[model samples]
Structure formats: C-alpha cells, structure tokens
Target chain A: MNPLPALAAAASEKATQSGPTLAVSDLRISAKRDRKSVELLRGVSFHVASGETLALVGESGCGKSITSLAVMGLLAPGLSMSGEVALTDAGGRIDLVALSAAERRKLCGRRLGMIFQEPMTSLNPMQRVGDQIAETLTTHGICSRQEAARRAVAMLDRMGIADPGRRALALPHELSGGMRQRVMIAMAMIGEPDLLIADEPTTALDVTVQAQILELIRDLSRERGMATLFISHDLAVVADIADRVAVMYAGEIVETGPIDQVLDAPLHPYTIGLIASRPALSTERRARLSAIFGAVPEPGRRPQGCAFHPRCSLAKPGLCDVGDVPLKRFDGRDVRCLRVGERVQA
Target chain B: MSIANVTSTSDRAPEKVPDARWLGLLKGLWRHRLGRAGCIVLAVLVLVAAGADWLAPHDPTEIYYDYILVAPDSRFWFGTDELGRDIFSRVLFGARVSLQVVAAAVALSLVIGAAVGLISGYAGAWIDNGLMRVMDGLMAFPALVLALAIVAVLGPDLLNAMIAIAVVNTPGFARLVRGETLVVRELDYVQAARAMGASPLRIVARHVWPSVSGNVLVYGSLKASAALITESALSFLGLGVQPPTPSWGYMLATGMQYTQAWWMSIFPGLAIFLTVLGLNLIGDAARDVIDPRTQR
Candidate 1:
C-alpha cells in the first residue's frame, strides 16, 4: 500500500475532516545570487497527520532547517521557493504558499508553533522570560496579559522549570542553559498550536537537559495531540521520538519509513552508512568505527545520475554513474537506489 | 494526573532556592567604582542643564565694561571675556546650549541610523549591499568637511550647525549599528523569535534592538562630544551662535582679536576641552561595562 495515498484518503474520509494539519508536496527551495542559484531542497515531500510526529533527519546543510523554514514561510529573502504547503483544520484547507505575509503571520504562533535549536540565543536578552512567552500569547489574540502570564507560569512549571513564578520575571541571561531551553519549550507550547516544528531542539543542550527536553516534548505532544515536524541531525534522537523518519542527503530524501524499521534495517546506502558510522555498544573498544567516505555533494555541482554515487560503498560500477534513481517502494519503505531491486536482506 | 500532581509537589521544593546570578549583577553594578562615578557625573550634568537659569551668577551676555577682561577674582572666579561678560555665567549658560545640542543631535542620529542599520544588516542581499554602499559614499567625505558643507547649504545658525553635525555623525552610527545588528540577528534568540512567529518589526524591536542598544548608546555619547566640538568650530567661524549671545565659541572668536587678552580664549577653550574629555572617558567606561566580551 502506498502510504501517501492511504494517508491522503484517510485525511479526506474523516467526518471531522480537519484535513492534514501540514502537507508539503514536491517542495523545492533554492538560494540565488547575482547570477547563480543553489538548490537547497529538491522535490522534498511529506505530511504530518493531525497529532502525529514526523522527523526529518539529515546532517548539516542537508536541507532540514530550510525545509522547516519553508513550512514557516520564514526563508531568507535571497532564497526563492516554489512549492505547495497546504494546511487544513476547522477553518478549511488553504494553500500556505500563496498566502500574503500578513495572512501567514496570523496562522503562525496561533495554529502552527515552532521550537528553535539553541536556547541560549533564542530568547530576548533584555526582556523577561515571562514577557517573551506572553508576547506570543498576546500576539495571536489567544489570551490577555494577565492570563498569558498565568499560563506562562503553568507552562514553565509543566516543563520542569524550578520556581516558575519567580523565574518568570527573570531575563534569559539569568537562566541556566537547561532552564532557557525549558523556557523556549514553554513559549512554543503556550499557544497550543495544531502543528509544532521542533528544529534541532536538543542539539545545543547537555545530555541530561536533552533527555528532559525530549521527554517534555513527547509528553506535551501526546497531551495536546499536536502534529509535530521534528528536524534534527542526530539519528539517535530521532529514533527515540519520531513516529516516522525521513533521511535526507544534500537536498533530497533518500529513505523514509517507520522509526523502528528505518533504525533496524535501512534500505538506502546512505542510511546504512549512517547507522554503521555510529559507535554502538556492541562494538569493541579498539574497533575503528565505519565512516562514509567523501562529503555530501555540493548543491550546485551535484554529480550526474545519483547524487550519493560518489560516496556509496556499494555503488554498481556503471549503473550508479549513469542515471538518476527515483524513489521507489521496497519492503514497505521508500528507498532511492538502483540496488533496491537486488535480493539482499539485513 | 496524579503523577503530574506528584511532580508538581516535587518541583515546589526547589522554589525556595534563589538564583545567585541575578542578585550578583545588581551588586556588581553598585560596587563598580567607575560606573558609579560615571552615573553621578551624568546625573549632575543633567540637573545642571535643567536648571541653568538658577545656576548662573549673572546674565550670561551682560557686558560689564568696568571689569573688561578681568583676571580670576573673588566675584568672577573664571574672570571676564573680551566683551567684559562674566565668563563663569556664560560657561554655565553655555552648558545648556552645548548639552541640549548634543542630546538632540545624538537622539536624531540614533533614530535615523538605527533604523537604516537594522534594516541593512538584518535584511541581507541587495538591500544590505545597497545601504552599505550609500553609507560608504557618505563616509568617504571627511566628517568635519561634510558638516561644513551642510552648514554652508542650510546657512549658519546654532540649530542649523547642530543639524549639520548630526547629519555628519549619522553614517558612523549607521555603520556601527548595522555591523552589530548583523551579528545579533544571527543569534539563537533572533532565530527563536522568528520561529515564534514574530513579525520582522517585532523581532527587530524585541530581540535585535535591545541587544544593540547598549552599543549604540556608547557610540552616541562619544558622538555627542564630537558634535560639541563641531558646534564650537561653527561658532568660532561666525556660523553658529551670533555675537551678544556669549557662546564659548563666540568668546574664543572675540578673544582672537585681542592678542594680549589671553584669558578670554583660554578659559572657554579649556571648558570645551574638559567637557569632551570627560565624555570620552565615560564612553570608554560604558563600552567596558556593557560589552561582556570586553569586560575582564
């Protein structure tokens, strides 16, 4: 069964028909200069069923952040985007790509919330932590200042921040790195958005704080029934929280499947390489960890045929160098490789 | 729900423990000797400017012919200028003009420069390139020469001189603010604000602006001293406050005609020098205090 069609049909057939909370199809994004344009996201497509979590995993410059920014309509001015981001809910299915900036802003922070990567620099240094969170609540017309403050305090408490009442008045600088991350989570969840985009949410945090933040995100997401697009470079983190995972390389998705399947048996060579590269506990202390040779292909100068051919250890002598391999279904998973047809088992 | 309730109870125990950093910053500022001195000086200057009339011993412009160019005496510690005007009275009144022009000019430049800089730095691409190019063109001209040209165009007066000085100073501030804004805009907080769905205006106002304001203020204070010097230059050239007004610059200009009357020019020039020197010292101290990277 094709997951796309099944999900789409399921989304349409529901009596409530609140539509797919966030959907992007064949989305393409590029950054342009005077005479050159570098494609950052090429034909990437995904959807988040209402209250489900979808993770986009990739290394730096793999277009994860760009994809999230595209969803938020917050791409920098030099970059041009062409795609469809459709959002449907109690209001109706509206194409987000075509909306005016003002209209998009109205939907943002209210219907769609985002948790950024770094907590240290993500907050206003001069403003109190409570005011920053309150600003979100008030901007979207969700609650009054008094109500927002009360809610902010509660949200902070829920995130395991100590002394929510007192800490609410503190500036961002006054808080520890972990506390700041909690404040960020609280601010994002205050509006109770239908969809939440957490881009590298735990990347900048300590291991303990990272675990706490991830747990808080999971618990809160479950409670609110919020559809989330979790973007991260760490495969381990994604495996823990993501319902489904999309592995990206350069600017395209190489493989996607349920988290367990993707983690246990990856189809794409890049995914296999990634899993092999990690330092597993079963490996001996003196063993040299496996690493994928060669960097990800540059955006503008990507090699002909397969973009990963230059780095794939299992690349067929002639087949990998000749033509582009479109994403195809294999063992109920999406894999883009000429070798997918071969009889190989993990 | 019961688990959450239990967690809340556990969380409440930590509420009594206070964060030491918040209290430390306040105490640190209070104990900083230079910062305290700078604050006191700024406050006194503000108060003196506010009550110039009550502070002056005599009419600033009244010509005392009987005591023409008198040396420092019991009645007139600062002596008299070439016009026989009490130099002490004129200097006190001159504080009102000097401080007012500096304050007003600095404010105007800050508003104009900050807006331009924030937009240029935050919104990169052709917009940033274009704004920077324009700023470069303005900066290419010498500061004093640009001010002189502006004064020449608008015609000479103290207010016009201030306006000219402000225009000349604007590019420096714009460049400074733009550079800082670029760095601050890339900060995680700015990215967080954007993710939170803050409009460009709101992000700049809340996230970007506050981070850069401290730096801008230090630059503005330094520029105010430059503006004071510029105003004096224009006045000495007969392009600022006219005669019978008793401006420090005017007194210096009048003293030039009297080769033997050294007291006339010396006192006023010294006042101008000391004021600028004090402002520069304070600006340096402010830079050290506000910028964490510079603080030891």
Candidate 2:
C-alpha cells in the first residue's frame, strides 16, 4: 500500500505552515572517538523561505556539507544531532530531527529534494537516466511507472536536454557531466518539492556548464516557488545564485546577510578574507590574489573561543582569543566577531 | 507542445528496444580470441548434448556380446567397453549430465550466496560480522570434503550431488558479492538514492544489484568450472547420477580399471577437460569485457 500521502498528511497536521520552508535552529552534531567528543557542527542556525536561495559558503571541512546532510537526515552513523529542524510547507509543519528515520525518509523526495556536488558520480551508472528520474516518483508512490516515465521525459526536456525521449534511454555513463547534472536536477525537481538542497551542484563542471546549471537551478526554483539551500565554497558562484549567504568556519557561521550586502560590504573577518581571495574579471594582470592565512581548523582541534581567531587578520590577542564571539545582529547582517567595525583588509 | 511531443514520441513505440550495451558486450567477447574459441567449443558441446538422442549410434546401456572390449573401429567409433556399451554414446550422454549438474549447482549457489552477501554487506555492523563469520566457518573445510559430507548426509543421488556442490561453493560467491556490495553501497549514486527516499531494499535491488551483477556473472562462470570438477568427483566416488545413467565421472571411474583399453579413460577425460577449458576461457573473457578499464 502507498504510505506517503497519509504519512505526509499526518506530519503536516502537527504545526502551522506559516514560517520558512526550512528552519534549522541551533542544530549541533557531535561524535565520540576514543573517549573524546568532537563537535562537528556547533549550534548552527539558518532558514530558507519559499522561492528564496540561501547559500551555505565555507572552505572544505567547515561543516557546510555536514549541515546539508544533517537537514536531509543522512548523516553518517556515529554522528548524533540535536535541536529543531522544522520544515513547514502546504502539508504542515514537521520537525525533521524529531521524526524517526523511516518517517523522515517518507518526507524526502516528496516535500524535499537534493542534488549533490559530484555530477559525474552522483547518478546510478547502471540505470537509464530516465528510469533514474522516474524512480524518484515511484519511490514516493507519486504515480504509476508508465506515468512516471512520461513525466521523466518531460522533465528532461524541461532541464534543456535535447531529444528527451532518446536521452532517457541513455545510461549515466553515456551522458556528459553537464547532462548528468541536468539529469540529477530533473530527478530532484520532478517531485516538485517545497525545498531543494543543492550541495555544490556545479563544483565539478567547467565554467560554461556551471553557468548553465546555476541558471537552470535559479529559474526552476523561482518558477516552482521552491526554497533552495545552496552549499558551495566558491564565493563567485554563490554571488550569482544565492539571495542570502551564510559563511561557515570550523562548524560555526560567522556571517550571514543578503548576498549584495555581504559581497559589497562584508563584516566578519573570515568573510572579508574569502572575498579578498576571490579572483575577479576586473583584477589587474598578475596581481597576487590575497589569501586567508590559516586553514579551517579540524573539528577535534578547533581553537577555543572564536574558531576563526587564528586566521583573522584583525585578531587582537587578548580580546579575540579569550572570549566567545557571538553572532551579533546589526542593521542588515549578523557578524560573529568581537571587532565587527574594524576596517582591516584581509 | 514539448510535453505533448515527448509523450507522443514515447507513445509511438513504448516497447523497450534491445540494449546496445549487451550487443557491444557480445561483440567484445567475439573479438577476444580465447573467448571466441570458448564460445564455439561450448556451443558445439551444447549441441552435441541437445542432439544426443538422435546422434548416439546405439543405446548407451545396450550390451553386444560380440563387440565387447573392441578397440576403436568404424562400427563402434570410440570402441566398446567391457560391458559392450558404446563408449562414444556414453560420453555424449555424460556431457548432457555434466552440463545439467553444472547449471543447477551454479544457479542454486548464486541465488543463495548473492542474497546472503547483499543482506550481510548492506546491513553492516553486527549483522555483517555475524554473517561473515558463518561464511568463514563454511569455508574452513576443504571444498571436496565439505561436498562429500553433504552428500553423505543427503544420500547419494544426482540432485543431492548438485546440492552438495552448491553448498560447498556458496561461500566463495558469498564472499565475492559481499566484497562488491561493500564498495557499491558507499558510492555517490547509492547515497543519492538514499537521499531520494529509496529504502534499504530498493537501494540494494536497484543500485547495488546492477553494480555487482558483472562481478557475479564472471565469478559464476569461474565457479561453474569448479562445480564441474566437484560433480565428477562425487559421481566418480559413486555418490552421484547412479549406475546405468552413463555419467562421465562414473565412466572414468569404471574405465580406470581397463588400463589396456585406454580409450575408456581417454574420451571421458577429454570431455571434462574441454568443458572446463571452455568455462575458464569464457570467465576470463567476460572479466575483460565487463571491466570498463579494460574496454578500448
């Protein structure tokens, strides 16, 4: 028997459906190894409203991907999460963290969908691309197999893939990297979810394909009025796609604001460093790109107080290293730094 | 308009076309010299076995007193045995028997082993440990001895012999599938499938199964050759196929006593050798064809 409709209905009945499509509040994930506890994500909070795009930007190992996985309820075993991950939609409000794995799964690919970073390896090599997309529909008991097949082809066409019917018969390996990512997009969007979490969806593609993919994602999200939680390490890519951007460093978000504000007038020291390191078309020839001094600290070995203090060019020894730097709200942004007003260039 | 075009394009001919990938595999197999030879030899053997009823000159069990112990000649072909039965006819029938046992034993082991391995690997942690330990226990005994013990318990018969060989070979397939499944279950596609709300069962069937099927098919072909040897050993020991059924193993066993005749042992041994060679060659060729790195 089909269980999704009833299950989703039951979940949506618990709370009012008025807030953001996804609201992750104070979500923390930690694990214990050899009697030592390592907190992977320390009290992270964010929200993505309908038709809005929120980019989670960070360097590698800064808990950006882990945050996305946490929201999907797909964290690796041994990592435990706490706090509210409320998902509100037409169905109703449901705390994803509160639901059992089985219940969370029922909501996935139905109310929420996700695309991954590596388009090359993200699709099943053995399955036809069309069948793979159709499977998402069938898994949620959304339609019959034949209908799913027809819709799959239609979705492929909508993704700007040429000859949708013929391409549908092609296996993942037979498709190009751009085509495969498009297939992934088709698969994710076919469910017409309220929220779509894309984890570095264009990191593996060339510049041309990356632009195309970003445009496709932007257009589709806008058309569907879908909330998008886009994760990426490239400030340039995030600039073109994200409405708002959250910068994470060593498991904590140091700055978050509307994209234009954060890009034009960044507040946090880490965010400033990221923007300085970025290469722009207008940069003078052979001018050296600025870089943040230190790598993102490992989760287990993160520095006490402010995690970014070690790498911050604006760091003051006594003030930055000895106290917790809370995420403070100003006029248009939240900056997690003790010296938010300082004009020191990274 | 595009949606209608797509719907109509699919509706025009909804039937599935033959997969080009399979056609390419066959072409690749034909290009490999040893693979081609193996295919030809197995095809001939299968034809010989299938047409045994019309092809055999005389009843395999018929006793001709005048022709008893005759050497190779025009009338009796590979000549007559001590019991005056045609050796050629018996060998042909033995081919049929050996192929049947190999098919049954391999299929049975593959089903059980693949299922066990998939479940054990996909449901990791304690279940993986427990199931693998059991498989290790089964593999501890020498294969032939294990088959012998199984035959002893189940009683001496063709079906029991197949069962014995299957049980003896189950651990090999289980280990291979478990190893492949372990790698496959961690791939990005599998993780993507999970994010798409695919359950454990669906993920295993759709993602893990296809990824590992090539390895399983190659392994199964290799196992068939081993199963052939085991089936012969069981029948040679008089625990399989029974007398008067004209099994190659039994013929070889009985023929060993007639050292002077020589043809008795020579012909049956040739059949086993050729069949095993064909299966091994096919297995090697299949491995080359199915592996992407090996493809041109």
Candidate 3:
C-alpha cells in the first residue's frame, strides 16, 4: 500500500482542527453532453492556510479558473462536481460540498469573497463604485446600508484611491483601469472574509498598475490574515504575490510547493517549461521566449500516463505514455512525473 | 496601505464637473433642430391643454346660434361647428380629454409591461418561456382589433377606451423590455452581483432595471404617440368619450357629415395632426438621443 494517502489523511485531520482556512480534497468535475461525458477536473486538491496565498498557475484552458470557481461554488450549470471541500469558518469545519445552493450562497461574499478577472466588466456601469463595494457588506447583513456605505469609502481610501468619498460617487466608467481594479479589490475585501479568491485580478491592467495591485493584494491579505486562492497564467505575477504555487496541467495539479522552490528548482517537466517560458530582461535581443511545445490537451483527449507527456521534453516514449502516473512526494514537494527519480539522481 | 499613498497619485484625471446621463440626453435633444421644434410644439400643446378652461374664448358647451357655421373669422379663430358652438373653444377642450387618456394609458402599459419583462427575462427557462409565450399570444392579434374587442366587452366609455389602448400596448413594451433584460442579464456586472451573493430580487431591481430603463424610456415615448392615435380612432368610431366632452375624434366624426361646412372638419383635423406630429418628433429625437450608437 502507498504511504502517501496515509500521510495525507493524517495531515488533513490536523488541518481540520485549526490550520488551513480552505481545504479541497479529491475534487472531480465532469460534464455530460448527450451520451458522451467529459472530465473537466480530475481529483484536484489544495489547501490555503490563514495569511498565506496559494497561486494556482496554468495556461488558459487548463482549469485553473475552474478550480477556483469550484471552491467558491460558482460552477456553471451542466457541470457536475463531487468530493470534499472543507471550509474552516469561525472555528468550525463545514463541508461545502454538502451545503445546498442557498446555504452555499449565504457563505459566499460573507465567509468567502471572489474578485473576477475583468475589472472593467466586473462592475455595474450604472452604479457608483462605492455602492458596488458597499453591496458586499449589506448583502451579508454585516451592517446597515448607511454604515456599509461609509465603510466602503474607508475601504476605497485604504485601496489608495485619492478623494475616496468623491471617487465613491463615480460610476465604473469614470474610474481608470487601475482604479477600477482597486475598487474591485476593495469590494472583495470589504466583507473581511476569511478566504479570498482572486481569479487573475491583474491580468487586464498595465504592468506598473499590475505591480501595485499585486502589492495591495499581498498587503491586505497579510493585514487581514485572509487566505487567498490566487489564480493566474503568469508565472512572474504568481512569484510576486503567492507564498506557494501549484502548477496545473489538463485539469490536474502536477506540482506544488513553496514559490521559490518551484521557480528555482522545478521537479515536474511542465513546471520547468513554464518557468523557462517567461520573458526575461537579460535574454539576448531577438531571442524567442521558450514555450511548452503544445497546448494543454482538451479534457477527453488527454494522454494516458500523464497529460503533459506529449509536450514534455524529458518524456520517455513507452513509460510516459503507458498508464496512469500518480503524484509522488519528492524533496518536500509533490510532483507527478515518471522520470522525477531519474532526474533527481542526475 | 498608508494614508500618504493616497495623495501620491491622486487627481490623475482632471477634476471637472460630473455629468449626468439624462443631462447629456437633454443637451443632445436641444442640439438637434427637429427635437427642439418638437419640444416647443409639445410644450405649447401641453400648456394649452392644461389651461383649456382659461384659454378658450367661449365655453365649449355654450351655443352661439347667431354665428352658426361661421368660417375662420375675427370672433372665432377656428370657426363655428354644426351645434353653433365655437369650434376654437371645443378644440381647446378636446386637448384636455386627448392628453388625459393618452398619458394614463401609456403610463399603465409602461409600468405593468416593464415589470413583467424584467421578471420574465431575469428568471430564464420555464418562467421565461411561459411569460414570453403569453406575451406572444397577446401580440399575435392586430393591436386595433384587440383594443376594439376590449372596448366592446368593457362597455364603451372614455375609461374603457383608455384601458383597451393600454392592454393593446402592453405586449409591445413587454417584448422590448424582455429582449433588453435577456441581454443585460448575461453581462459581467450582473454575474459579479451574483458572485457577491445578491438576492435575485435585489439583482433585478438594482442592476438589471437600471441598464434597461433607457431603452424603456425611449420605447415608452414612442408608444405614447401610438396610444394617442388609438384614443383618437376610438373616439372617432363613437366608442370613446360621450358627447359634451369635446374630444378631437368625436368632433371630427360630427364634422364629417357636413361637407359644405369646411371649417368644422379642418380645425379639429389640424389639432389631431399637430399633436400627433409633435409627439412623433419627440419620440424620434428621444430614440436618437438615448441610443449610444448614434452619438456624435
């Protein structure tokens, strides 16, 4: 019998007592179209401790966003999800998967808050930005509308918007892109949620604004002791704000560890490729950024042994394509690759 | 997170006066010549209608038998009718009846239809299908025929005529608002509202309603003119306001029988034409002003 399951079970038992703010285990999501079925997410699992940010990194269509949405109970209709999603709320561990739709909705924007990808579209154009932020607080009955409105302005000021009182009165279109993102952050953070899900919050902003938004997220998470599940395709951005990183491929997490360790000495070939693909300031002029050879395989078409095997440089033909390859513990991190033992020896 | 960070990059954009959307629409309407003309004509019509008691030279019901069928002359600017009553005074009183029916009918349809559309569109699947199918059924019949049937069943009177017009127009408003709601419901802000745990009712009221209101306002103005035409048609058919009320359509009906007395038909006919023209112009201008695609 593999000892990994036993070890993980023991750890999770302790996790339930008082550790991670959010813990998702063996989550599987599948979709049905007529007689055919497709697995969108396969046994995805991760945990985020209080005051720590766990970045789920992957290219587009690799289910990074899906994992976050699943955690938040915001998956689209026609998709089915199963397995345990344990959320630690006010010293109690509630299995979110067991909650009804209305019960789940009550927890959202109260115990948990999410910031979407598009800042421009995430806000109601007709409403004042301050009212939008205040809505989060009033929605959960945390405070009266009048009190919520005042706190919303204070939150906006904390987000670094100048003349926040007047700015609060400004509609979504009146604010700049960066300011809009700050407002989004303020909206998500206003409830003072225990778990914050930021799904590529800075992807639409300018580079300078991107850095500032990342800093704001980090500082706020630290200040509030909030556990953040940060989803991003950008490795550089993940390295900047995330304490830990999980690299996903074809709907499954392939490698996960401390951010520095994953970036500097990646174990999985996919992680290695991801870190290598980032454009660096030191690269020679005209040199093309290295990228993973092929796109992430569609759910139903993924290869047998490992989803990344077809694009992996270190993949051996017969072994890598033979059968299911399980995630194994390796050097204080988890990695899913057949040749990790050989790579480590070398 | 410091207070100093707030001032460091504040005021990047120039601090100009905040502009309201409706103010922009008003400015746009004023800039267009036809819109300005429509505004003036409608303003005068409303004033005349409101002050009909004071404005008319003679009492609408009072008879002046000595000057029967007189042409447009010094005493009667619009001439006298078959009853020997001043046509000018009758037409002024007719404005009051016409404006009252049109305003009440349009307001009823706008309120009821907009509410139905909003609820149906936001709550998709069976509710949407069921509500929309009912609206479609209502719209299937010709608007005039439907209004006539309603008036016939409800008993012919000014109130019954207004109700018939409102019922006929409800389908149009419902269909328009439903379409707008379907589009607005899928927008990201709405999804953001859902993510924030907003109740369905709150989302519909606060988010969905505001986005579709501009289109509703434009459509309502356009429908208001149609309601006026319907009200006039009902009165002309003798199924509307009873005699002594001085409705434009009733006056037109009475005047048509006396072909030799040209002043009788011409004055009432001119009132109907001018009011309809003013309303149509205002509707057209409102559509252009509210429609973002047409903005200069």
What is the descending TM-score order?
Answer: 2, 3, 1
Instruction: Report per-prediction Cα RMSD to one decimal.
Output: 5.0, 6.1, 4.4
Candidate 3 per-residue C-alpha lDDT over A1-346 given as tens digits, one digit per residue, 9 for 90 to 100: 1212333333334665447889999999998866688998999988887777889999898889988888888787779999889887676788999998789878878888889899989898767889999999888888999999999999989998889998898877777888889998888888788999999999998898899999899999888988889999998899888878899989899998777778889999999888898889999899999977877787788888888888988889999998988889887778998899998899
Q: Per-residue CA lDDT of candidate 2, range A309-344, in tens?
A: 888777788988886788988646788998876543
What shift in Å separates residue A227 of candidate 3 from its native position after superposition? 0.7
| Docking band of candidate 1 | acceptable
The Cα RMSD in angstroms, rounded to one decimal, for candidate 3 relative to the true structure is 4.4
- Global local distance difference test of model 1: 0.79
Q: Which ten residues in a row have the lowest lDDT in candidate 3 chain B?
A: B1-10
Regions of model 2 farther than 4 Å from truth: A1-18, A341-346, B1-23
What TM-score would chain B receive for each of the candidates shown?
0.85, 0.91, 0.91
State TM-scores per candidate.
0.89, 0.91, 0.90
Candidate numbers, best lDDT first, in rank order:
2, 3, 1
Highest-scoring model, lDDT: 2
Q: DockQ (Cα-based) per candidate? A: 0.36, 0.35, 0.37
lDDT of the candidates, in the order given:
0.79, 0.86, 0.85
B196-270 per-residue lDDT for model 3 (tens digits) = 888888889989988788778778777878888888889999889988789998889888999988888888888
Candidate 2 contains a number of clashing pairs equal to 0
Label model 2 with its docking quality class: acceptable
